[model samples]
Target chain A: MHIDLHPAGTAAALAVLGTEISETIGARVSALNHAVCAAHLVGVIETVPAFASLLVRYDPLLTDYDALCAQLRRLASGLNDEAAAQGRTVEIPVCYGGPYGEDLPFVASHAGLSEEEVIRLHSERPYRIYMLGFLPGFPYLGGLNERLFTPRLQAPRTRSPGGAVGSGGQQAGSCPRESPGGWQLIGRTPLRLFDPDRPLPYAAGDFIRFVPISEREFCALEAKKEGARP
Target chain B: MKILVPGPLTTVQDMGRRAHAAKGYPECGACDKYALALGNLLCGNEEGQAALEMTLSGATVAFEKPALFVLSGAQANATLDDRPVPMHEPVRACAGSTLQIGPFAEGLRGYLCVRGGIAVPPVLGNRSTDLKCHIGGLQGRALRSGDVLPIGPEPSGTTAESLRHAAGILREKPWLLRPRTAHAYLENQVIPLLRAVPGPQQDAFTEEGMRAFFSGLYGVTPDSNRMGIKLSGPSVQTIDGSDILSDGIVEGSVQISANGQPILMLADHQTTGGYAKIATVITPDLSAAAQLRPGQTAAFRAIDVREGVRLCRETAQQLRYIKELTIHA
Candidate 1:
């Protein structure tokens, strides 16, 4: 449980829990985040967990930087690496190809696989959520199969619709809102990834599984509210 | 209140959404937080009350009903109905009065606080408009012509007791509520000298690169926005390469891009960043940094993190002291 600590800003410090980007390192980051919150370390206003680091925001009025560093060091030492504490799984329905997935064929050719093969390789496995940051509810998903791995587009797209499932640099991401992106978008999901009404739909350490659906099914799901699908 | 002419990037904001960063939501709020806080304070409002935060440009708001409002941040020429009104000093506006604010003579962003506060229902526990996602504020967007905003009930208890002051007559203050942070952004103010602390990835920079960062005068690039103040000047590069596994980004982080430009992350910055950060302008100066517009030159001076923390504490104390001092007003 070696942690490298540095001052993030005047009010906060970052705890880099791991060096490499992997499930093991990510788990350690998640555990340390949970431990610090569970312990209620004084002055901790918020914690932002990324690939293998957790940035803790604190109030200087309540606690200073040195005190926070020592407190985080103490909390990180007692963290359980293999803790069962995890976020719930979310199933996303995708419509690959045509208007919804303009880059589906491009991704298929880039990976040297059939369109069906690309979809299977992507949807077959569950990916762990790293953290949302680039856009609201935009999930940075890990665990993409090497067979379907493809590089980002040479020229980025000006605008992508909400629920765009895109891949770049050995990682896949879902766009919760329409925004400019540079990734190779292979498909689109009907469900709104970032509805404010939904009570914290996703978090770090959560698991995401993709379910493929026909265009007709996708339209039906899009029209229906979450959890009310026929 | 009705928006006759909307300002650029005008939105309802409070202190912002800070508690949910671990879940990946960046805290989006007023770029100049201290200005907003002081504006709310002058209006006899709480620290976290929603206020209209306008950037670069100013908005034209027509009041259908009477309201008490205070303006702060950049200097803007404001008029009540057609008569000019003083800024920083509180004003009690009459119903059917139109308050037209400025083509800013100085500074970038300005804050407008009403007595009850902007009553827009908070999204994710904040009235702030997260422009990245387009949620919250008036229809999750900036103020537009013909949009009506409802102000909330004023909170009880105040120092100056601006809330209790009679509303029919314009209650104008003779003196100004000047905060230390606003000094750097005032018109005719010198090129800002921002005190900085080594960022999380300072080691990523080479010795010469670090020297370039400290010595060079970074000019604010036109690419700047509420998300960050992008600068292009002395090229500051890294030793090996400038790619960090995506990590959490601080609000005032000075991230150096592949092209060697410094991008100072502001209020609406993303929660995590992949670029290598060389330094962070400590708190108490972020407001000054937010007011920087394109073509403005800002230089960094390194300071001890402890001193930065101490100065931040002093700033907090100062705000409290102001609240008490206003008791007699």
Candidate 2:
């Protein structure tokens, strides 16, 4: 995999590890993210991994652009074939259609498929976590069924409930918190995508496989979590 | 201490909630880091300690016990028990004394730092209030009327003793003797000449778009906030369209929207953005961008990355100088 380094700002650089959004490139992005982070070059503040690029923010006081760039190039060259592979798979239980999935019918209508077919298509494969962005703990995944491709709403939804599973433009994402959005919602996951107490579960390169569940089961799990909370 | 009348917007902030950006959280903190640090320095508190980030308006704070605090940034009309207290100096307030910070005479944001600092529980290694997720500082929200904030224990060693006599009155030091004078100067011109480096997508802009970005003076729009400073003026167009693959966004990224109006991302910018960012404001000048008021015009000039880094180093030296000026140091 080839990585192109570009100046993002005065103190940061954008490393384009791959050109397109695909599972192979996504995995490579993860590997580079792992390698660069593991190298821990002086002055590197944080490395943010997105779809196919990593934004590395650094401190100018510790190192300048040329020195850091050379160090990053050297580090990138030595990355082992065996990446710091972390593919911890998470099984998210989701309730499809009805009140929980506000735009299920619309999605089905857009795809010219029955609601069940849409649900089956959505849950059939494991989606790769491309990045975490747009909202806290929100996962930008790439593994939507080609037929499931849909456009964003003409007018954005002012508020999307937390845990709403949505898709738009061949990308599927689950809302980690209640926020305004434009993606068409298909389902809601009972599981919390984010919690301050827990470490961010899905990093770039992790896998997310959704499990379809009934509305009743979703409520049951929600109530169980609420009951467990002190 | 009770807040007699909470300002329209006042929240506790420190450096920022970094590291958490990977989780899509914006590192919301003081918009003006230099001013905040200077205020903390004057109060003999660590720069990272929590301080109040006051908006256009200021709140009336009632001290339960005697405390030492300093104000920085905006030149606000302040009074201590009906008497005016000096800004940028340590002042001691007796129990039940009320500190009122009112409308600003200049600048938009202000910072009020206490001796030990605001003792709100820190979430994720910061006292910054992330209003989006309701995390960090005073229950993850802005200060409200009647809200009481606990003050921490006074720090052990600092310049608090040296400046004690000047308490209740303005600082006695000359303008040159005081620290960080040039860093906190108010703007006078209607247009700010912002220095920037080429963005990752700088090549994506058409020749005309590039020309407009540097040639035109854009006015800050009313729709701007901590998220970003939206500007309205000559629109820049991309030869490859405005869309780009989603990637991480920086605080000073000048993102060109579909409409082509530039939006200067700031303190509370999203972790990642999809629009094509034509340029990025340099680190040293981000403070200037933060103070830009709506309807104010701004222009940009291209500078090499090395020049921007030089400015950043100078800024760091200023911070170091302030630390050394402390009596404890």
TM-score of every prediction relative to native:
0.91, 0.92
- Per-residue CA lDDT of model 1 for B1-329, tens digit only, reads 99898888688888888786765676888888878887787777876789998878789999988888888888889898888977776787888889999878888888998878999988888889887767788788888889999999856666335333311122343222333542234366477878888878989998999989987788888889888999988998799788898988878999999888899999889888999989888888898888888888888877778888988887787667556544434
lDDT of 2 by residue, B4-83 (tens): 88887898888888777777889889888877887887788887788998888788999999999988877788999999
lDDT of 1 by residue, A1-230 (tens): 77899888798798887767888887788788778888887788888888888888889888999999998888777766665357668888888878878888988888889999999999998888877777667788999998777888778889888788878869988887787888888888888666676755668878888888899988887888563221
* Candidate topping TM-score: 2
Off by over 4 Å in 1: A80-87, A95-102, A214-216, A226-230, B159-189
Question: Candidate 2: DockQ?
Answer: 0.73
The per-model DockQ list reads 0.67, 0.73
TM-score of chain A of each: 0.92, 0.90
Query: Could you give me the TM-score of model 2 versus the true structure?
Result: 0.92
